[model samples]
Target: MKTVGLALAVTLLATVHVVAGDTRFERSLRNLDPSARLEQICDYTAMLRIRASTPFRPDRAVGSASSPAKAASNMLVANGAAFRSRKKWYRLSYTCKTTPDRMKVLAFDYKTGPEIPEEKWNTYGLWR
Candidate 1:
């Protein structure tokens, strides 16, 4: 019984690790085209502040019957970033996909503004 319990615990931990791994996410971000609009505001050369939220259900697929089906365990969410401007700070959101193999950004919209009080921008050390 003890051996069975130990095996189950190890299996559970391995499952959790596989589900949470996100190695490809940053890799995708690094592969973004330099001329892309996203590059204009956020300086990838400098350190960035990223805040990832809880995993959420991704939107259901539309008309593409030929595409591979996504697993129910795969989760997606929008992650926040704090970046430095000339002398100011700004925020943007990057859409990310979390799968057993890796996590990567699917697509991201344009950067936003100076950020608000509730955003806790200072926590990211953007003010410096």
Candidate 2:
């Protein structure tokens, strides 16, 4: 239920840091492999993009909540993903597509479900 952003970012930042641009983020992506890179960008996208208005700011995103994310070519789909806003964890699912180089996000879609039960948190490897 947290992030490093790309997987690189998701893997990079254990928690999100407010930034003005992608300069530092871009540099960070260079450190991750392709699969991780895909996760990172998409995870970052989840926190940054959304049409449905929510109250709190999501500070973190996890590519895998109850299961590992699936990747194929330049696309990554994570059905068991989750994100943390303030102190609550919400169910999440996301689909991420990247450019040929797998460095830029070409398209992304995600939906956040209900708040996860605290009792199920440990089972899902979620933390406080």
Q: Candidate 1 on 1-128: residue-level lDDT in tens?
A: 99999999999999888556433435565465532313321222112223222122212111111222222333222234444434444444433333333333233333343433534544554343
Best by TM-score: 2
Write candidate 2's Cα lDDT for 1-128 as tens digits: 24544567654454445342576888888899887888888888888874236665888888898889999999999999988888888889999999967788888888889999989989888888
Candidate 1 worst ten-residue window by lDDT: 56-65
Query: What lDDT score goes with residue 22 in model 2?
Result: 79
Report the number of the highest-lDDT candidate.
2
What C-alpha lDDT does candidate 1 achieve relative to the native structure? 0.36
Estimate the Cα RMSD of every predicted model relative to the unseen true structure. 15.9, 10.5
Tell me each candidate's TM-score: 0.28, 0.78
Off by over 4 Å in 2: 1-21, 51-53
